[model samples]
Target: MSRKTDPLIVRRLRGEERVLEVGIGDRTGVAARLVDAGIDVRATDVRPVAAPEGVRFRVEDVTAVDEPDAFHRVDTVYALNCPAELHRPIRDLAAAVGATFRFTTLGYEAPSIPVERETLGGGDTPRLTLYTATTRDGTPRGSR
Candidate 1:
């Protein structure tokens, strides 16, 4: 199947030093595309995952007791088709790590955290709406 999550994320995150792709459940190409763009990508899921070429995979529960180490180095943290329940936790993780946090929600679920919406599509590119978390500070909510 084609990865609905692609180039847009790659497009938006250009020039980042490193990034974390959270809840990469079956949407592995998101990280893959980020990698092709020369961004360092590390993806995580609660369970183990098969990483794409040039992408690093980790088993992580963002809501777990210990923080995921990937946070320390990444400049951005994002998820695609993230469920409503995870919006806050993931955004909080990004906040704690001083990373810019963003996500796209499942169609029916309203965002549970503050966000700025962006529409990503026009022509052959599939239309996708993505949410970038807005933190309390001037920075993106997740970033310090």
Candidate 2:
């Protein structure tokens, strides 16, 4: 059986925009697929990484990035397997990188992963929901 991907993740790409994948594993299958579809992709991790050709790779921490205008008008930001506490950081990264779309994946239950409801500073922390603007078929219900 073939595993299905979340359609909202890739149905509207113009095939030539810059995309950033944060917390990407050793090999970025999504990035590869997007590149095959003609998008310019970039992969970044907290530590070292060796990226494939045609995909620019960076070694930087998503939470503490300090580069000014470091990206080339990023269209999308993918953060798979990221902890809920990291959501704000991811949001900051996307904003810093100029990403218009942000995609993230999380588990359904608590304790399965470290999803802290209260941030370290204190306040009602928002859960890392996918922003659910699109359907399973990738038809967006509203604009971002």
Candidate 3:
């Protein structure tokens, strides 16, 4: 299935030079596309997986990130179709590193992180929801 939200995710990261994609799984197409567009991107998952050419891969778990400087290395953190249980940990990781958090959830589920939602794709394409993390002050954390 095609990911309709890819464009929107790339758009939201327009000026960001680098980003870390969490829970990359076995697919690296998105990461490859972003890299082709001149954005520096890296991917991480709980288990090691093969990645597209030029896309760096690492093993990481959002729920149990032990690397003290894990989040500090990137300007943004994102996960596509992540589970609800991981929402808060990703948000916390972003906050702790002062990076932006963005993610898409599985359809029929709600996000656990506070976010501003945007819809992408039309017609038969499954409606995709893109979420951007917000600060406690009710503002997009990455706006600055």
Candidate 4:
């Protein structure tokens, strides 16, 4: 079976070793695609839920990241349709674990942190904004 992917997510993360999907309530599309692409995908949620085969699922709350070890050395930490309220915690979590942080918003809210944005899709596909949580000691990595 072919796994459906968020083209943008898979595009950015496809070659990475491992990924942590934050707040994966019931949506499995992203995880499935990652797994299919041979990336080790682990997912977390506040509730006890299951992921598709090949994905490691755990109950985790990014807002209060307790088991930092569970995230150690992961390539990335991402969430779909994340809210502004969650931007800080997960960004902190990813930074603490030395992983790249990325997410998409629900369209009704703005990012609460400094981020590098990318526009996803073209032509017939619907456009969505993808944000990479970043630092600006200067500025985001991709920007001069």
TM-score of every model? 0.87, 0.63, 0.85, 0.87
Q: Tally clashing residue pairs in candidate 3.
A: 0
Give the per-residue Cα lDDT of candidate 1 at 129: 84
lDDT of 2 at 62: 72
lDDT of 1 at 44: 85
Worst 10 residues of 1 by lDDT: 64-73
lDDT tens readout by residue for model 4, 1-144: 112237657877887888998888778888888899999999998998878899888887778766688644487888898989998898888887778888888778888999988887667766677888879762542222
List where candidate 3 sits over 4 angstroms from the true fold. Answer: 70-72, 123-126
Query: What global local distance difference test value does model 3 have?
Result: 0.77
Clashes of 1: 1
Q: How far in Å is the alpha carbon of 53 misplaced in model 3?
A: 1.5
What are the runs in model 4 whose C-alpha is more than 4 Å off?
A: 1-5, 138-144
lDDT of 3 by residue, 25-140 (tens): 86666787888888888888998898778777778777887553843467888888888999888887777777888888877678886788877666865566788889767787
**For residues 39-106, what per-residue lDDT tens digits would candidate 2 score against the true structure?**
88888888887676677888877767766355534766666656666666665556555564344545
lDDT of 1 by residue, 54-82 (tens): 88888878887256454445888888888
What is model 4's C-alpha RMSD?
3.7
Q: Kindly give the stretch of ten consecutive residues in candidate 3 with the minimal lDDT sum.
A: 1-10
Worst 10 residues of 4 by lDDT: 135-144
Displacement of residue 32 (Cα, Å) in model 1 is 1.0
User: lDDT for every model?
Assistant: 0.79, 0.55, 0.77, 0.79
What local lDDT does model 3 show for residue 93? Answer: 78
Regions more than 4 Å wrong, model 1: 1-5, 68-72, 136-139, 142-144
